[model samples]
Target: MKAPPPNILFFLTDNQRNDLLGCAGNPIIKTPNIDRLAASGVRFENAFCTSPICAASRASYLTGTSEKRHRFTFLTSPLQSAYTDISYPATLKMAGYRTGLIGKFGIATNGIVPSLQDEDAVEKMFDVFDNYEHWTEEGYEIRQPDGSVRHLTDITGDKTINFLRTHQSDHPGQPFCLSVSFNAPHAQDNDPRCYIWPATEDHLYAETQIPEPFNAHPDFFRQLPKFLRETESRVRWQKRYATSEDYQRNMRGLYRMVSGVDRNIGRILGTMDQLSLSNNTVIIFASDHGMYYGDRGLSDCWQLNEQSIRIPLIILDPRADENNRGLIREELALNIDIAPTILELANLNVSDKMQGKSLVPLLEKKKVDWRKAFFCEHRFHRADIPKSEGVRTQRWKYIRYYEQQPVYEELYDLRNDPHESFNLAGDHRFSNHLKRLRRRCDKMSAECA
Candidate 1:
């Protein structure tokens, strides 16, 4: 009998920063389970999202295409069925894999309030789809089958475990793909407390002193362009980080939410081990996009800053040779690459329409000519957020706000100014360098379009 393919477990978190994990060198945040996953898998040291917003990045991850190609951005836009049909989950399902999706699927929220009615089309992509949107009041108010309300993270973990157990019983010889998306660490915009987590996690970082980033200072906020200084970012900063107490409260709440999610992940990992599925299951951990914890006086993740664009990517393929296990790669990885990687892992061919290249070569430690740079873009979300695009190379980053009058630009030598503190776009000393990057950015933007 031919052996079935390996099972896939993908965990996607919301509004998580790259530096949140203990393995990522943060001394404070507790992420033992994720750190364990990293210890047993390959961690990409510099993974970034193609788009910094929730819907666009999630779409990119599904279709393995850029935002320009997917044509889904903004809060009220629904991802086209055409794209969803070709999405990784849909493709995997077509290829005879039992696919399940749990937790928050951000791409289906097209109206003022996320409705299950609107998700009827996208729900067909998965075999066992639980399309829950915790961002909405109705979605968050849902109770478990036991008649007890729980945190969204706990509910998601329970659903994931149930799905795994059911799949094991119904299809012991068949492979399955399960996607668990958790809406954690993302601030509750409608809640009075802003950030919400389990009550048990209230003391996770209570006594710890959370240091503010350098850009959170008023002077740094003043240094921004007039448009940025007046954008919704500044308003959110005022609400979350204007005062020391507010900063600490919000930061601690955010960390607590993350810790809560991590605990649920630990439970999932334990279940996998108990079921003896750990060895044959390929595990992936990542976020939709990075978040800004009061960086640049910004409280959200619309900007092209490093804190907003960079995300954590860890992949554990049990089939990998010993030499590649627990290896850390410095090459750039993007959210769009996720689909191709999963398809490659299933021993399937990648679609030509996918702009992302598979990371299988890197996981296998094979010699390949990788990309030199990648382009990222942000379309207008609100009146406060301007449309912008940029190209990031290993040593430099160039951002241009095309919608703004006079065309604002930012050029940062990432090697020298990793925090993006200095914008050398207007400096005559680097005129040639800036000009080259601008042309490169323009060319890449055109190609992506």
Candidate 2:
């Protein structure tokens, strides 16, 4: 007998990177739940976001297209001219699964500088998030709640719990998809003090080792703009502490925030177990992109380096295949592939318009030529310069800004120059390599087009 479709509990985080989990090799940040997931599921060692900015990357994940295709480059607008384009979640509904979305939507795509962020614009972004109240048999309906909502992460989890509580057994054994997004550890207010994390130095144990290109970039501020001098928190913090005492304070707090969400995830997982959905369910945890945490002279997660583009992706589907349980795969994966993967998991029709290939075959141990370079892009400053894109192959990373920026090119040999301190774009020795990387950029742009 053919088995029923498996339920999908999709968890998404904002402004997150790949190094948070102990399983991902950061010893100090405690993410027992995320680590547990890593231990039990396949972890994509080379996963990447299609774009580093919040809105553009989130839109790419939703629409299953490249930034060039979706054209939702700015946060406020829908992709291109199509407001009703069938996003992956909406497509799940076509495949006979109920769907729900909660938490941060990364809707701020218009190049609105943070310094000039209008109060009204922030409210508008918040409104787009709650515009679609909930889904029903009739159709996706508009919605607004009268209850006081605080802390986007808490609200996101609560909504998921509420949806689960209300929709018990509504599927009549058919599978459902629940997209629960959290805004934790994203520095919501742009102020570290505004962070809700409770992890402190006294409670934290010894600092865990974090591997990086440079032991420390203490002089990061020397090259940064004056306004962004405070961006080099990592370097400043490093100089202040004699040992690893508070080295992990901010990081431990991030872990606590992740742990907060993980606890809720545990509850959600426990709910599935109670409902007897474990044997036929798929759970996924990933982020739109990563954060800098004061790395490379950057205050936030807007940079295009591996620190900002590399994100964590895990898939745990007991029904998909039992053979790869607790198995970790190092194959290159991109956010572009998420659409097809989800569609394949739901046994639904994957659109021809989708650019990513499914990981189902790879998960099943089937051989395929996956990818060597993970493509990523960003428009963080949204300055007069139009665009910037990056391509990271297994050994090297190349980045180019396409417009009026003063310094517009970068190339790094990940194996040797991990800090990306030296830009080789103008070097005669790497001219051939630069040509190759430029060709890659053109190819990716064409593919995305």
Clashes of each: 0, 7
Worst 10 residues of 2 by lDDT: 133-142
lDDT of 2 at 34: 71
- For candidate 1, lDDT tens digit of each residue in 43-89? 99999998999888988998899988877776645667666767788
Looking at candidate 1, the ten consecutive residues that score lowest on lDDT are: 109-118
Predict model 2's lDDT versus the native.
0.64
Candidate 2 wrongly placed segments (more than 4 Å): 81-84, 108-152, 190-192, 198-216, 220-249, 320-322, 384-387, 405-407
TM-score of each: 0.95, 0.81
Per-residue CA lDDT of model 2 for 300-395, tens digit only, reads 555577787889998887764456766677788878777778888888887787777787776755567778885677654443223567788888
